[model samples]
Target chain A: MNTKAFEKLNYTLSLLSAANGDKHHGCIINSLHQVTASYPAKFTVTVNKDHETYQAIKASGSFSVTLLAADCPEGLIDCFGYRSGRVKDKFAEYAVKTDGMGNPYLMEHMVARISCKVVDSLDIGSYMLLVGEVTESEVLGDGPVLTLQEFTNRGKTTPPAATVYRTMAGNGFRCTVCGYIYEGESLPADYVCPICRAPASKFVKQD
Target chain B: MNTKAFEKLNYTLSLLSAANGDKHHGCIINSLHQVTASYPAKFTVTVNKDHETYQAIKASGSFSVTLLAADCPEGLIDCFGYRSGRVKDKFAEYAVKTDGMGNPYLMEHMVARISCKVVDSLDIGSYMLLVGEVTESEVLGDGPVLTLQEFTNRGKTTPPAATVYRTMAGNGFRCTVCGYIYEGESLPADYVCPICRAPASKFVKQD
Candidate 1:
């Protein structure tokens, strides 16, 4: 696989966030696009079906997209992206505000916050494509949005796992959703990932 | 409407190109994403239903995505993005090469080129969602990919009109796909947009 070639396809990364009452969930997403030019502006967001943010948006029919800036703190990604909403309240750890519609958007290190209402959705095998119309939008900061290339160049390899962070921890399983390494003698049936809260079914044995 | 907010959501843009035999088409698309992690890698690209590239991909069941670089020539965008395949052969004007499958991939200032075969599709009102599995991917150059913010800051406003080049002609109808302004008497019913090759029906009168 031409892994480096794939990295060259730089894309703007964002935090797809949604809230169902006090339950706020957010996840890092690389696939999003503006579908129309204002006048009930539309946008499309694609997410892995197993992701907690996907479940939150599906239940609420509303979500907020916070465009992460180049200067965004690493802690923000660790809290909202590395940790799952099912086990942790990401908003509690960060300074954020809820819109009138109840979606919590990050207040720090973000360039803009756009609120949306889902008008339609499509199911692809492992992901769901949500089509939504922008209800409200606001500029939060003047910093440039972060691109995948910049993120990679900054030595921040997020997702499935950061190759540099692990030290071959003795044939353990890694969480596919949050990249949490679990070291154990045998896979337990009732075990759930501590970092992303994904079930045992979502863990893949380390090579 | 917070117009400036949209600018904050800077995304990397690319030209989606496809060919069936000698019949080729390419169009500008901002919405594309990797659906799965490698191994018969999957991707989804959303394109307007009216776009010629959409018909070409639907017919050929294959396509190529070229990640335009920061230094990509303006003529490339003007030719592929601004013009349609129905009016003329865009590939004829540029120096391009074909892959093993005979798909035309731009050899110019592109960061990477990915070839895919369409696996599934969905209708999303104004656009079609094409799901394709990556067959091949190669890095064309080490140049940085172009993002929407950089393109805007470079003063390259792609459509409706180029903000820097135009003299603001009075009461002109602009091609919706490409920003070519027709400055003349009542638009002829048979008039086709020279820039984008869109019909008179696709023109929207300037405000």
Candidate 2:
């Protein structure tokens, strides 16, 4: 198989956010799609089971999706894509608004925001495909939406500082499932990944 | 709902194809996503149940996906998208190749091709989300993948001739579910959409 061919399949990057009580979590995801165009249009999002946002959606049964704009900064991608919400408050640094369903969604550098209620879910081993029915939607801007290929191109110029530093430190154990890095001397045998909830055995020490 | 906002959320266009015995069919779809990055990568494609390609996949349990390149001609999209494979042999005019499973995939104006077997599926009203486990993949070219926005922009310059003629004739009826237009003088009570299988009741007579 030509593994590199998969990279040519461009996906639009979006911010997926959910709330459980007063706690809100957001993550960057590229696996969002509108499955149907009928009334109460249906959507599907694939989230890693270990993500805090995934847990939030499971507990709240709702989530908001914001399609990133072409001008979205690399820093926002870093904060939402690379960092784990278990240790940091992603919304603290960004302007956010609650959708009609009470789920938090980003308010800047996005082309559109859609609120959805989880109707059903399918488990695909490490990931869960959440089928959601659109509860509310808004077109926020006219800017072109960002694609994963464009994001990768931007990173080629200057990689995310946090990711670069963590990888260079050589003290990080990366979660093989979700790419979450745990920095320490050695991973605890019973440690579970805060991001994807994978066991310590699923991590490989950074080289 | 700001319905116009949905227009800004660009999606990558893909050609979904499948075969059952000696018959082959293909359709254009945008709701395709890579849900997992494991050894046998997983993907999810939402296909309208009425589509001939969807039925072919259901019968054969496998399909091929080709990501359209930026330079892909509008005529190809018009043929694979607006026309029904149930009445026309879509592969007749195009060069094609079969995968390990004997599913035909497009060979031109595409950036990549992936062959997958349906591992699971979820029903969401009029659409079925087919979870595919990659059996083989190949990068066909280095060109950028096409996006729905780009296609729309191209269409604005010149609408598909078949669609324009059908709509202008005033004798056509459009499937409310999948936008498949049926050209005829009158609707038959027992008629079911050849594209989406929606009954005559689901068709709206063009004004």
Interface root mean square deviation per prediction: 5.9, 6.3
Q: Highest DockQ: give the candidate number.
A: 2
lDDT of 1 by residue, B1-207 (tens): 475676666656687888755788887666556765423467777776666777778778888988888898788777776676778788887777876667787878888888888888876555667888778888888878887667768786643211111224477776655556788658999999876678899876665
Candidate 2 at B156: error in angstroms? 5.2
Q: Write one digit per residue (lDDT tens) for candidate 2, span A35-154.
A: 765445777887877678889999999999999899988889877887777778889988779998789988789999988899999988767888988788888877889877787786
TM-score of 1: 0.85
- Largest lDDT belongs to which candidate? 2
Single out the weakest 10-residue window by summed lDDT for candidate 2 chain A. A157-166
Instruction: List residue ranges in candidate 1 displaced over 4 A.
Output: A37-39, A159-173, A181-192, A205-207, B38-40, B159-174, B177-191, B205-207
lDDT of each: 0.71, 0.77
On the 0 to 100 scale, the lDDT of residue A81 in model 1 is: 61
Ten residues in a row with the worst lDDT in model 1 chain B? B159-168
Clashing pairs in 1: B160-B179, B161-B179
